[model samples]
Target: MTNLTIIQQSPDPEQVAERSRTRRSIADKIRGMGQNRIGALLLLLATVVAILWANFATASYEAFWETHLTIGVGDLQLDFTLHAIVNDALMAIFFFTVGLEVRREFAIGELTSWSRALVPVIAAVAGLALPALLFVLVAMGSGYKNAWGIVISTDTAFLVGALALIGPRVPGRLRVFLLALAVVDDIGALSIIAIVYTANFTPLPLAVAAVGLVGVYFTRYLPSGRGPVYATLSIIVWLAFLASGVHPTLAGVAIALLVPVYRPDRRDVEHALELARTFRQSPNSEYARAAANSLRESISINERLQSAYAPYVAYVILPLFALANAGVVLSPEVLQGAVVSSLTWGIVAGLVAGKLIGVFGSAALMKITGMGEFGPGLTLDRIAGGAALCGIGFTISLFIVDLAIDDPLAQNEARVGVLAASVIAFILATIIFRISDAMHTDVDPGQTLLRPVDPKRDHIFGSPDAPFTIVEYGDFQCGFCLKASGSIHEVYEELGDRLRYVWRHAPLTQYHPNALAGAEASEAASLQGRFFEFERGLFTDQEHQRPSDIVRLARDLGLDVDRFERDLTAPEVTGRVQDDMLDAEAMGITSVPTLFVNGRRHTGPYDAQSLIRALSEGPPEATPEPQHPGG
Candidate 1:
């Protein structure tokens, strides 16, 4: 019997309930981590703490990391300094998480589609190449040429945090662009670490590691509760890679690549549904409980494992990594010498000047050559700003520096360059983005904090838990919304269930007098499961929008006419409609049919292709600060 079938046959109610609760807890935790702010804050705090500890409590900082730790059985043994453990072991988890993310992107995210992936891919390449070239030019023959990889990596946490600090004027598309670019940049960085930084290769262990990786790939078909097996195999792979002289962290990437992505199979889903139907008939049966458990297991192992591990890596491992690696003893004399050193200047130049030229220049080239263009809502000015922000290469840069340069003094100087460049990049990027913001449309300061879509409350047309969500705040009577509705419909038709389309009323009471009534009508129809029908009808027949016509449309759509009429003026319905308007207004949405695809604003033309293309690349829209009437 299939594991899920066996699971569904479980007799224990307590076990089923407990498992459900655990799953929900994991889902909640994953959602929290996805928001990015808390982890960013933690990383920043860790870096600051490390810097302070390094400069002030130098001896203790050094001693704590130097404390050796050993683990083994009998003659087989392994030893590591605390710092090495943090760097090599803890960072493996971090890289594994990164690998999962990269795999996801490649498998199903923006990177899956060439149309969406090209710009970011080009930009990432340019971003990496330019930084390296600049570093070489600046540091060549200056005893720091080996450290060029330091400037090549982008600190995703810092870049994201910096963007968050910039607030809502930063278009959602820019975040996506930067994120995709960083992911590609990461792959490049890790590859460099694997190939360029390897000291030597032991053939036997390398072959054994390859075998372990192959074994790991086949484990996907293995039965459930094989955690110990997977964990043991992973460690074996890691240690083998270590002995083979490749950066052991690449083993994380190798393992992640092998983890099967969990797209629900049609046959499995159908079987689960059949089991669920049977469970409904015998609700109290052990078989029913087992069926529920089976359904849950149908979710991919990769997704479950990634969720379970992501928070630990982000909040704990990464922060510890920052604490261990970011610490550089910056004494006055050391600082003075670092400033004069070409290593510092090379890093600074590579990070700031190289990133700017590379990212912006490549993007401009794409636009000029008709090769590719930025995603919707990403302007060149904003891209320039993003390019500037790319210079904040803090974490990975330091990791590379540690691996590339052996001399302690030289490492400190490179660290100095990294620190100075990060500060400079943040400042310069802020100014550029702010200016871009001012030059563009007047943005409400409240739009900085983007709100999350609550599937529980929001009326979604597709799967409520779809990976990409498009929320439109539109007024039925607005002509622009009418046009936008057609494009939105086209997008829904093309993307199918992969896209969740949510409609929120943003009735322009000042202009469209019938908009409020229209919104209420839609909400009222929603009471009878006719929300989308009413919405589609309204958009299709713009002229038939009065209260009487809405009632007729609801009737035609087979909604309970009496109930629809009664609910049209219901307080809750009115409140729901009003709430949507309030949300739109708070977000500084001054116009009709403002769209947020996966939380990012779609500021491009209201065409089907543009809207579809934008949503295809995921980014959340900035949330506006909610305000009541004069509250």
Candidate 2:
């Protein structure tokens, strides 16, 4: 007998099932953490601990946060208490992350176009203005009318966390809208901090800060050492702002706004790929260094800095800020005083009532006047619930209290109101979402296509008037989507002209980094009348859809490579992909390779035989009533 015997054993089905279950569990946990639910819980725990410490061990709580620290080089030194360090220094990083997000949205995200941004921008303005107005109305005679700035901002971290805890049935569109609104709210709050609260008017230091900001802006053109340059300039700006007696945290925002943000350039991506190939073939230190640097340089500095700093800001900085700032003594005297304090009632009414009415009313008015439109499935009811959640203002509200009110007793009263309002907002939002979900219980959003297939806009692979239709919401980088592509090909072959197959971009960006790039590249290719061909190329090499790889595919298919590169970032191309994604979201299609036959969603295995059977069955019978409960 030969020593080498060919033998293969099939894997156990139970083991496979176990692995799948394990993967799903891990994914769910990761998703929860990414949504900042864990961070929010940590913040809440910190606030509770601070409150308990302040009540039971008031002297120790005060002593601990009051401990002073100093840092310096040579003759220059800076001294601050632990609480000031948390509020002034670490919080700058938090605000820097906020500025990065704002710049990104303006450059490439939801606010890239006026049409898309109108509703959120108007709503955010109203959300800010109305809260301040309400606060002033109630607190005008309380000797703290100037503290109206305290309620104009929403705490984004808590807002997102509250939504996660509430667990709305379909919160995708609503969450996006609220996040957009929060970004604007942050701008308003930062403006108030800079314009309304600054006490000193030192022109020399302000001029120095402006120079540092200009230096930071020019660092993007540097061929190397931009990171160190940015770091040096940012420090200078922070120190200048601190010396000027303007809020030092605003310097963080200034530096962050100056950081360049853009889509990845084709040339830069190709250069990186070339370096990567060299490193792979040579396996040398020099090539490795070059390849790493190239890859890092391909992504915009704004995005890179945001990724580097977001985790620290969310998990460490914000939690530490809460611990330092939320230590209000809730004694019987304070509670009784707060009950009669107009300042307390003003904060509650501003955040709770003003945020709800302002945000929801503006969005509703925009819709009614046809000034702007909401994303699919972002119903007025969901917007109302989201607006209620926006009332949970904690971080900035407390920070503003410290700045806007000097009296310890008044600060304590304001803290109580912020905490109480947050709790009330969470409860109110939960109730509203529950009611909305219950009212729409008869509608199953995931079972039907929200948008009809349009030949002029969609990527179609067969005759437009085909008797049978198959539409797929797919991600280019998904392994399952690649498999589904093969099955779709088989179906096309079997049905010939009878089948009209459509591909809609539903990139699961959380899992697939290159999926959105591939989607945009395909849309770009579609402009040259070769969408299906480029799509087939993407599926053929699903593992390598990098920017470089996409451009190479375009060249291989004899496309106008230059125009293709330009079109890859064209607003129309990006919008086309976004439209498909929004439609998929409206239908609650969270995963890839979701199929629809005729107009009804097809659920189950999407093999060629199964899909063909689905296509043969045709569209399901329509109910007499309309499907959209919100409509």
What are the Cα lDDT values of the candidates? 0.75, 0.83
Q: Which 10-residue span in candidate 1 carries the lowest summed lDDT?
A: 20-29
Number of the predicted model whose lDDT against the real structure is largest: 2
Query: Model 2, stretches more than 4 Å misplaced?
Result: 1-35, 73-76, 454-457, 460-468, 477-500, 508-514, 536-549, 552-559, 585-592, 604-631
**TM-score per candidate:** 0.68, 0.86
Q: Candidate 1 — what's its lDDT?
A: 0.75
Q: How many Å off is the CA of 532 in candidate 1?
A: 12
Return the lDDT, model 2, position 246: 93
Residue-level error in angstroms, candidate 2, position 55: 1.0
- lDDT (10s digit) by residue, model 1, range 1-631: 1011111122233322221100011011112324466777898899899999998999999999999988999998899999889888888888887888788768645576576678999999999999999999988867879889999988887787778777335345567678788889989998998888888778899899888988888887777656777898999999998898888888898898888774544346557777888888878778787787677677776787778997787689888988998898889888998888999999999999999999999998897787864433467888899999999888889888889999999889999999899999999999998888778666443333245677776888888877767787777776666666666666667667777888887666655556777888889888887788888898887766755677678878888888887776555576566446545534656565567866777654546655655665433232332222210
lDDT per residue as tens, model 2, 1-631: 1122111233333322221100111011124435488778888988999999999999999999999998999888888999999988899999999999899888887788787788999999999999999999998889999999989999988988878778467676677788889999999999999999998868799999999998988888888887788888889999999999998988889888888899878788889989999899999999999999999988999989988887787788998999999999999999999999999999999999999999999999998888885656788889989999999999999999999999999999999999998888889999999999998899888787777887876778889988778898887877667766777788788767777899998776766668888899999999999998998899889888877789889999999999998888877788778777777767866566677988888765556766665676644342222111110
